[model samples]
Target: MLSGCVLAGWLVSGLPALAAFKLCNQSYDVLNIAIAQPGPEQAAADDFVTRGWWRVAPNQCATLVREPLKTRFLYVFATDVFGKEALSGAIPLCVGTRRFVIERQGDCLLRGFLDARFLEVDTTDQSDWTVFVSPRPS
Candidate 1:
């Protein structure tokens, strides 16, 4: 379980905002994060492509999607070094024990992957967004 972790999102400020999806870790320990987005053929396949295992250290940030935002929503899941869930949500997605890029969701166990709940982030169609992960209030 997450021992007091909070995830928040916002846009970065600059002459021209960086067009990318980023996550900043303010938690107390290292974290492994995953991201899920609509598949290239989402309209026809109605599926999502999930990628993961970005090792983020405390007080640092990682650029998950290094391009202009194309989707209004993105899903995220993260865990601490000990495999304890640090951030999650209602969206169930598929993940793997090692680095992976799962092409679809559901039947995780049968598909040789693990089922994980991901927090859905609404970017409000912003071109650039940053998610800050920090310790929850005591």
Candidate 2:
């Protein structure tokens, strides 16, 4: 089952904001996050690009993707500093022990990576999006 992490999205108001994908850590502990999306050559290879290991402090936000959002769906997986699963979902994705940029999914162990289940976040075609990771309820 997925943790009680909350995910919310909204457009930045006021001045024009740069298009990007961001995650906010509202939990009491630091979080390690990873994200996956359709790769640039997805249409040709039907693959996904996953990257991760962003250490986000409590109450802080991190920009996972610094460019314009291209896809409507993004997969995310997060764990606390203790290495306990904090947020996850039904979709399986490949992740690494440290900072990594994996080009494809499946056969993670064979490829020298770990397999993780990531929560799917639908951006609804927004240009910029931020996912708020709230603390799991007591």
Q: Which of the numbered candidates is closest to the native, going by highest TM-score?
A: 2
In terms of lDDT, the poorest run of 10 residues in model 1 is 1-10
Q: Over the stretch 33-95, how does candidate 2's per-residue lDDT look in tens digits?
A: 999999877774428888989999988999999998889999899988888888888888899
Each model's lDDT comes to 0.86, 0.86
Clashing pairs in 1: 4-136
Q: Against the hidden reference, what TM-scores do the models get?
A: 0.90, 0.91
- Spell out the clash pairs found in candidate 2: none
TM-score of 2: 0.91
Q: Model 2: which ten-residue window has the lowest total lDDT?
A: 1-10
Badly placed stretches (over 4 Å) of model 2 are: 44-46
